[model samples]
Target: MAYCGNIRQEGCGKLERREKYRLFLYVLLIGSITALFICWMILIWEKIPGAIHIRAGIRQDLDLNVPVSGKLYKAPAETEDGAIPVTGMNAAVDAREAKTLSVDLAEPLTLYAEDIETYTMDLKLFGLIPFKTVNVQVINDKTLIPAGIPIGIYVKTEGILVIATGDFTGDDGQAKEPVGHLLKEGDYILKVNGREVEGKAAFMRQIEESNGEELVLTILREDQEFDLKVRPERNQDGEYKLGIWIRDNAQGVGTLTYLDENNSFGALGHGINDMDTATLMNLKNGSLYTTEIVSITKGENGTPGELTGVIDYKESNKMGTIEANTVEGIFGELNESAASHITTQAMPIGLKQEVDLGPAQILCSVGGAPQLYDVKITSVHLDHDNINRGIELQITDKTLLETTGGIVQGMSGSPIIQDGKLIGAVTHVLVQDPTRGFGIFIENMLIQ
Candidate 1:
C-alpha cells in the first residue's frame, strides 16, 4: 500500500510541471506580439503628415496609408464661420489603391481626426493603440481677384523698428552699446518710459525726455512683448540716443491678385521680407493705395528687374487697409473704388491636382496696362522648398517677352489663368533663363 501511494504522488508532481510549462509558452507569445505591435505603431507615426490642406468640395489623395486592420474616425466640433476650413476624410479600403487614406469634401468644412486603430478582436487593443493628431484645412476652391492693378503697400511695424544696431561712444569713458541685449535688428521699440511709442520720432522723443535716466522700454520682438530698462547716453553731438537705426514704415509696389465678393483682396504671391534684415515684415497697421506705373526695368539673363510706380496715398485713392502679410500674399479689405480696377469676374480657383503641364496665360501690368500673355508650363514640381513653386513656366507670348524679356520683378503677383479658371500666380523668375519662372498655385493663395 505504501509503494502505490508514492507512485500516485510522483504522477501528480509531473502533471503540475507540465501545466507550468504551458503557461510560460502562452505568456511568451503574447509578449512577443505586443512588442511587434509597438514597432508598427512607431513606423506609422513617422509617416503621417503634420497637417493636410485641401479645397472645399474637392478630393485630396493623401500620400499616406493605414494598416490593413486599422480604421479612421473624425471628431466633429464647432468652427467659426468664414474661418479657414480643413478636415480629414473617413478611412475605407480604397477600391483603386487598396487600404490607403484619402480626403473628399462635399462642402466647405473642417474636420479633425485622431488617426487611431480600435481593435477589439481577441486582444482588445482599443485605447492602447497610438495615434497621430491631424488638422485638416479646407478653403474656398474658387474666387475672383484683380489682376495687373498695382497696389501701394504701406506697412508699419508695432513700433519704431530697429533697422540695425551699432556701437557708440557715450559720455562715459568706456565704450558701450546701451541698446545691447535689450535691442537688436528687427526688434521693435514699442515704448519708452511707459509712453506708447508710435513711430521713429516718437521713440526718439521719449528717449530724449528720459533725461539720461534708466528708461523703461517696452519692446516687441517676434510677437513677444517684454520690458527692458536702459540708460540713454549722450553722444559727442550732445543728443541722447539708443545707438540704433530705426524705421517707421516700409513701402513697395505689388500687383493685386484678387478682389473677392467679400471685398477681401490678395496680392504679392509672397510676403514682403525686409531687404536689410531678410525677415518677414510684421504688420501693425498699413494702407494699400492705388499705384500708377512710372517705369519698368526689363528682365534679362543673370539679372532681375522691377517696375517703378507712384502710389496714390491720397484718402480718395486709398484702395484698402493692409491686414495680413503672408507667404502666399498680402490680404485685406478693399474700398469701393478698388472694385472698379478689376473687371475679371470672380472665377473658380484650380487645385494643385487640376494644374496640368500645358498652355496657360497670365494677366500682368508689364507696361502700365494689364494684358493677356501666353506661357507654357515646362514642368510641375512637387514642392521641396519653402516657397510654393507649383509649376515651371516659360514665356511664350511675344508681347510679354519683347516688352519685359519675360517675367520681371513687378510681375510677381500676376495671376495665371487657365481653362477659364485661376490656376496660379507668378512668384519668381529664373536669372539663368529670362523666359522661365515659378508660380504658386491659386488654391495656396486662397487659403492664405
Candidate 2:
C-alpha cells in the first residue's frame, strides 16, 4: 500500500512539471512575436523621409492685359425659347431636302478680351464663367484717352555716357560728310566740350555751341583719362546732333526676397529686366530697401495682376547689388550686414528628386500679412527635362487658395518644403488652373 501511494505522488509531480514547461513555451512564443512587431515598426520609422527647409524671398512681376466683360446666352431648351440653328440634314433624309434644323447649343463659346463693351449678364442662366463671344458695336471713343498723352513712364539716367557721330544731312539739302572721329564704345563721357555738365540740359547746350565744329570731349575709358574730338551734324530742325545716349548713376531701393541662413545672404530669386530691350538688366550696384505694402490688386478671371508699394529708403539700408543670377535664382555677396539669425549649420537643400506626394507648407507675406498654411504635394515628376518647371504642386491649403487664389503675383520665389528639406522655389502659377505651378529645384539654385 505504501509503495502504491509513493508512485501516485511521483506521477502527480511529473504532471505538474509538464504543465509548467508548456506554459513557459507559450509565453516565449508570444514574446518573440511582440519583439518582431516592434522591430518592424522601428525600421519603418527610420525609412520615412525628412523635410527640406529653405529661406525664400518674394518677387513681383507685372503683367498688363486689357480687361473686357461679356454676357452668356444659354441654348434653348425643348420646351423653352426659340429654335436652335443647325446645318446639314439627318442621315436618313435626302441630300436635296437637307435644310437648316434646330439643335441645342449647350456648350459655351468665348469672345476675345477686346470685343466686349459693358458687363451685363444673367447670373441665373450663364453662371460665373466669363463670356467668350458677344455681340458689340465698335465706337471711336476719343474720351477714353487724351489726344497726345504718354502711356508708360520714360526711364531716365545720368550714369556712364556713350557718344557716336555719323554722316547726317542738313536742312539746306547738303550731304554732310562723316567728318567726326568715332568715340570708342567704352568711352565714359564726363564733361562735354570742356564744360562741367550736371544734367541733360547742360550737355545739350555744349553740343549746340559746337554746331558742326570739331569739339573736344573729356572721357574715362577703361579707367584711363582721355579726350576725343568729334564734329556734330545739323538735323532737319537745325538741332546739333552728336547721336550719343547718356546715363547717370542710378540709386534706388527694392524688396529682399530671401536670406540663405546657411550661407548668410540671398536676394531676388530672378533677374530684373530692362524695359526697353526686355532683357535681363545687368546691375552695376543696387541697394535693398524695406517696403511697406499699401494695397494689393487681385487678379481676375482673365486679367493680370500687380502689387503697388512705395520704397522706404530712409528706413531701409543697402544690402548689396546682385552679383549674378544662375539657373537657381539670384546670388550676391554681402558687404554690409548679414542676416541676424543666419547660421552656418549645413541644412538640407532638398532635391526635387526626393519629393513625394504628401503634405507640405509655404511661407509668404501676402498683402503685407505674413501667414503659414497647410498644403499638399500632389504629384512629383522625376527625370524631367525642364527642371525649373519640374515638380507639379497643388495648393491644398483652403485658406491660402481662398485669399490669394492659389499663387498670386508677388508669391514667386516662395520656398517649397517637404520632410524638413528645401525642395524648390516657386517660379510661376498656371493661369487657367491657379492651384498648379512650377518650382525650380534648390539644387539648381545652389549651382552658382
Candidate 3:
C-alpha cells in the first residue's frame, strides 16, 4: 500500500511540472506578440514625413511633433562636413524613456537664400536607428494681392485636336467611316498633305477642298507623329467631311486667384479641359480679357452652377497674355491696364503646414465687386496624393450661400484666406453637396 501511494504521488508531481511548463510557453508567446504590437504602434506614431517646405527668411522651429524621440541631422552635402548641430531629444536609455522631439529651424533655414533651392536631411530614431531621409525645400515667401474678379480666358491648342470620330454619309447615300480606327479622340491633327494646318478654319477648308481625294494626314498622338491616308466623305448636303470632330481653341470665364509683385497672375485653380474629350488643352497662345458677369446659375445638389459673362475681345479689354495653361492653373503677366486695378494691400502666403482647420474666408466677386466672405476649413491633408485637394472646406457664409448657392463654376479660383494669409484657392465643389468644396494649396500654385 505504501509503494502504490508513492507512485501516485510521483505521477501527480510530474503532472504539475508539465502544466507549469505549458503555462510558461503560453506566457512567452503572449509577451512576444505584445512587444511586436507596441513596436508597430511606435513606428506608426512617429511616421516620418516625405518632404518639408520652409520659407527662406523665417525664424521658425521645425515641429514634427512625432511621438518617438529622434535627432534631426542635416545631410552632409548641405552642411560643412556634415557636422551641423544636432537638434532633438537626448538619447533615451530604453523605449520606455522615448519622447517627442523637434528641430531648431532657425539654423538650417537661415542658411538657405536665393541660391539654395532645396536640400535633404536624415532623422534617427532614438538617436541611433536610421528612420528616414527627408527632402527640405526652401522657398521665398511672397505677398500677393488676392484678386477674385472675373476674367475671360481664351486658349488655343498647339494643333487641331480631334475630339471625337463619327461616320458620315457619302454622296452615294451609303454610310462611310473614312476615319475608321485611323484617328481617335485626343489625337492632334498637325498637318494635311505635308502642309501645317494652323487653325480649325484652315483645317476645315483643306477638308472641304479635298474633293473626295485621298489625303495624307500627319497626326501627333501621345508625342508620336505618324502619317495616315484618309479620303473625305461628301455628305448629303454636298459638304466634304472628315468623319471626325475637331477643336482648336477654348474660351471661358474664371476668377483670378492672385497677382504677384511682378504683376504675374494665376487663375483657374484647375486646368481648362475639353468639354467633350476632357483632356487638358495643349496651349499654343492665349490671352486673358476683361469680362462682366451677366448671370449667375445657383448650384444645387448634384448639379453644378455657372456664371455667364460678356467677354469683349477688343484689344482695350485685354488683361494679359496667357503664357501657360497647366494642370495647376493658368499663369501670365498682367498688363498695366489690369495691374492698375489692384488696389488692395498684399498679404503673405501661408504654407501647407501652416494651414489649420478652423475659420477662414474667401475672396470672391459675386456682387460685381470683390469682397471677403466667411468659410470654415474642415480638413487639411499635409501630404495628400492630390495636390489640388489638400484643403477641404465648406461654405459657412450665409451671404455667399444665398448669392452663388455655395460655390459655382466661375468661383474656382477664388482665394481662401485664413489668419490674414492667402492659403489656397477653391478648386472643386462636391457634386452631392454643393456647399462643400476642395482647394489647392497656395504653395502649389506658387511653385507652378
Candidate 4:
C-alpha cells in the first residue's frame, strides 16, 4: 500500500508541471498580441499628409498625430541615411509628442523625408520602415497676368482623320459600304495603297484613282499604327468612291488664361472637340493667333451662348506656337508679352484647398475689352482629382448679365480670381441656367 501511494504522488507532481507550462504560454500569447497592436497603431500615425504645398514666406503646421499616439522624432522622408533640409523653414525638431511640425518657406524648394526616422530614444529607431516622401512645394504666389485676351487656335491632327462614312453603289450595282468598321471617327488615315496621303482631297484622289481595286490603308489610332484593307466601290455616277468623310484641321476662338514666368501660355480650360462627331481634336502641330471679339450671342434656357470672334490674319498678330492639346487645354510658348494688351496685374495662385464659396471675379471679354466681372462660387465637389469641373459658379455682375447673359462660348479660359489669387478658369456654361458655369482649378492648367 505504501508503494502505491508513492506512485500516485509522483503522477500528481507531473500533472502540476503540465498546468504551469500551459499558464505560462497563455501569458506570453497575450503579451505578444498587445505588442503587435501597439506597433500597428504607430504605423498608421506615419501616413500624415500625402502631399503638401506652402507659398513662400508662410509657416504651415503639419499634424502627424491623427492616427496612433506615440513619441515622434525627426525622420528622413525618402531614406534612412542623411537629412534633407526643408527649404524656407526651421528644420530643428523636438523629440517628444510629435503632433505638429512647423515649416517656414523662404524660397521655392522640395524636400523628401527618407533619412528622417522616429525613435523612442537615442538608441532605438522607429517610424515607417520604408519611409514616405513629403512634397513640400514652396512656390511664390504672386504671378502677373494679362486677362481677357482673345486667342484664335488652329490644330492639325497627326494624319488625315476619318470623320464619317456611308454606303455607296458598288460594281455589282448594290448599295454597300466601302469603308466600314475598319475606319472610325478618331482614326488617322496615314497611307493609302502604299502611298502617304496628306489631306482629305489627297486621300479621296488616291482612292478614286485606285481603278476600283482594293486599297490598303495604313492607320494610326491613339499613337498605335496598324494596316487594314478597304475596298473602293463605283457609285451611280460611274466614279469610284471610298465614301468616307475626313478632316485634318480645326480652328476656333477662345480666351487666354495666364502667361507664366517663362512666357508660356495656357488657354481653353477644356480641349477642343470636333463639333460634329464630338471627339477631342488631336493636335499634331498647331498655332495660336491673336483675335478680336466680333459679336455676342445671348444665352437662354436650354441654349448656351457664345462669344463670336475673328482671328487676326496679320502675321504680326501671331501670339504663340501651340505644342500640346490636352484634356485641360492647349499649351504653347508665347511670342510676345501678353501684358502689353491688358492690365499687367499679377496674382498668386489660389490652390484648390484655398478656394472658398463666396463672391469672386471672372476676367472675360464679350465685345469691347477684357474686364473683371462679379461672380459667386456656388459649390465645390472634389470627387475626382483630375476633372475640370471642380467648382460651380454663377454670374452676378449686372453689366455682364445684361451684355453676354452669362458665360459665353469663347469665354472659356477666362481667369477666375478670388481674393487676389488666380483660383481657376471658366470651362462650361450650364445649359439649363445659362447664367451658371463650371470652373477648373488653375493647378490643372499649370501641370500641362
> RMSD to the native, candidate 3?
8.0
- TM-score for each of the candidates: 0.73, 0.46, 0.79, 0.72
Pairs with steric clashes in candidate 3? none
User: For this target, which candidate reaches the highest lDDT against the unseen true structure?
Assistant: 3
- TM-score sort, best first: 3, 1, 4, 2
Instruction: For residues 275-332, write the lDDT of model 2, one tens digit per residue.
Output: 3333343334444444445556664455534345555444234334455543545566
Between candidates 2 and 4, name the one with more favorable lDDT.
4
RMSD of each: 12.3, 30.8, 8.0, 11.6
Whole-model alpha-carbon lDDT for candidate 2:
0.47
lDDT of 3 by residue, 1-448 (tens): 9999999999999999999999999999999999997797465433344666677656444454453333344444454432222233332223342222244322222222333355555555554666556766777778999999989999999889999998978788999888899999999988888988899999999889888899999998888999999998889899999899999999999999999889999997888889998988888999999889989999999999888989989999999999998888999899988999977789999977788889999998875789999999998776666767889999999988998889898888999999999999999999888899999998888777
Local distance difference test, each candidate: 0.71, 0.47, 0.81, 0.72
Indicate the TM-score of model 1. 0.73
Better of 1 and 2 by TM-score: 1
Off by over 4 Å in 2: 1-258, 261-263, 319-321, 333-338, 341-347, 375-387
* TM-score-better candidate, 2 vs 3: 3
Candidate 1 lDDT tens digits, 28-126: 999999999889756554434333455555554543444422222232343222222224443333356332333322222233222222211111123
